[model samples]
Target: MTVERRVGNEKIVELLEGVSRSQIIKQLRPVGDASSAQMNGGSDNVVASFKELIKRQDETIATLNHQIKNLTATWLHRKRFVKTLNEGIEAERELAKLKQEMAERCQIENDRKQAEQPHIEHFRSASLPAVAEQWQQYQIAQLPNAEEVVVQQLSAQVKQLEEQLTYGWQSFEVQGASLAQTSAQLVEANRKIHDLEVQLAAAMSNAATVEGARSQIRDELRKQALRMLDAMLRFLDFITLDAVACYTV
Candidate 1:
């Protein structure tokens, strides 16, 4: 058997079929004609490459997950903002309706002098002057000082309602802006993540193809090595058979 001992520890023996001697024996080996020590040290390189690939894949997945989570959070935030705005709008509408009803009732009461009505009986007190009480009490009345007082009260109420509406509008605008900005950010982030994943997948596929080609080349090299070893074994076999035939003759 002709053993090609390139790497010192490796024992590449004859690879004849059904032979007593074993074939190639190597834990790890470099393809090029490098030292055994160099080959042994280089196992770390393959390990490092695999680790890097795994790390990249993990990073890509994590980035994509974070983007998706951020988008979902933004969606929820917008939903809550819209719900709150709707509630505020409904409340404002009810307040406006109440104010309108109150104004209408006051107008109806003032259209005619109805002092004897059951509604105004409790609004007026016995100790107050008739005109003074009438002026101070019913939001609707015909008096010199009544219009100013009514105007002041209505103005205050309207101002308060206006302020509330303004606040609601400002809040809505701010939330809407936040939603728009968040949505845009989410979209951009997702796009970047998607691009990264595509790149990662392509790189991994390329790596796999390269590894496949390398494996095929290695297999062919091993086959050639085996054939060489087989020739060596056949030479030893021919000598043994010739010796046996000569002894028998």
Candidate 2:
């Protein structure tokens, strides 16, 4: 079903073929009269011995199949782990990019605010006081002996100037409130950026840990494969030695 299974099956077939070839060679070998007599008497015992070897070979194949399944499952799990880790890294990159963009926007906003500061200060420190002084002068000019129509017109002018002054103060208050809100927004953005940085740091730490674990897993898998190979080799040697002993007897 899988490449691993195919390879394992191929290996098992090769091992079986080699064993068959060895048996054929042994069968074809010429025997002395004494060996022939011994073989005739032990024919049943030889069949049982071969059956035991076949059983052991089957058991070895089953063990190998089990190990291969474990290897395949481990490989799949590692693949999923790496995919998740990559996704996390990509997300962190996007977050870093967003943080950079926000910082740039905040810098631009700060620059614009700085540029507008002079005009706002000029308006507050000079314009409002000048308007107040002009209004006081107009009020003083409204004397008891002034002409009726002229007094009425002057009263109307003073009232209009008072309205303008009130409107200007209101506009200044609104601007201050707007600036305060902008400052609050900037503070919130900065806090969010700091939080992102902290998360990025944690993600980096986790990535390092994952890397270490991956390396450890690789080493462990390599050791397991080596151990399996050694066991198989030893089993083959034992089978070969038993076959030789039977032939000699």
Candidate 3:
């Protein structure tokens, strides 16, 4: 029984020494100092890289947002320009319609005057002479008031026809000037619309370029993140090895 107790104590002491050695090895492991320095350096490098990546991403996002704002502004301008162009076109059409109506009315007036001109001249040259001859034979002294009344009526009709012709000519000239102005305005609107279209196309191209740049930045960031993850995995593997070594010791 005493031999058994002695052997048991020796086994217990051996176990205790093994446990102590494991504890000592764990405490003195190379995870500190040089190993920790390397790990910390790697971690710091990874953190710095991530910070740089985040900054670059933030810059990229800001640029993208700025580009979006510009694009939106450009689009809005294009829309308003198009709307104005359409309004201009509509006004031009309306002006053209007015001009056409005015022309038709003038043409009708001219045709009526042309049809009446020969009759008016015949009445003045032929009928007036005949009436004057009849009045003279009948003796104008006996019917002086009758001759005066006929002459006054013919003179008044001539004055009225002249006034109408003058007014028609003035109105035609005004309409002509208005039509010319409308034509000029239409041409200017078309030119502006064309310029705006060109600008819109350029803006679209710039937006595409910005999108491509953003895609490249995202791809680069993803690659960097993957590299950082691989580096962390390697660091973890190193730590695991150290722990295994301490256990074996």
Highest lDDT model number: 2
Which residue pairs does candidate 1 place in steric collision?
A: none
Greater-lDDT candidate between 1 and 2? 2
Q: Clash pairs of candidate 2?
A: none
- lDDT of every predicted structure (CA atoms): 0.60, 0.66, 0.65
**Candidate 2 on 1-249: residue-level lDDT in tens?**
322222345544644553445344444573664555544444445556557767777777788878889998999999999999999999999999999999999999999999999999988999889999888668666866547756777899899767766765665566557556656655665565566556555655686585665565556556655655565565556556545644453
lDDT per residue for candidate 3 within 1-249, as digits (tens), equals 011111245543543453445344544463555455654554465457556656766776777778888888999999999999999999999999999999999999999999999999988998888998887757755765967866877799888767766765665566557556555655665565555556555555676575665565456556655655565565556556545644453
Per-residue lDDT tens digits of candidate 1, residues 69-168?
8888999999999999999999999999999999999988877557546556655654457877666577456556877888888899899767766765
TM-score result, candidate 1: 0.29
Query: Of the candidates numbered 1 and 2, which has the greater TM-score value?
Result: 2
Model 2 whole-model lDDT (C-alpha atoms): 0.66
Please give the range of 10 consecutive residues that has the lowest summed lDDT in model 2. Answer: 1-10
Question: What is the Cα-based lDDT of residue 116 in candidate 3?
Answer: 100
Task: Show how many residue pairs clash in every candidate, following the order shown.
Answer: 0, 0, 0
lDDT of 3 at 123: 82
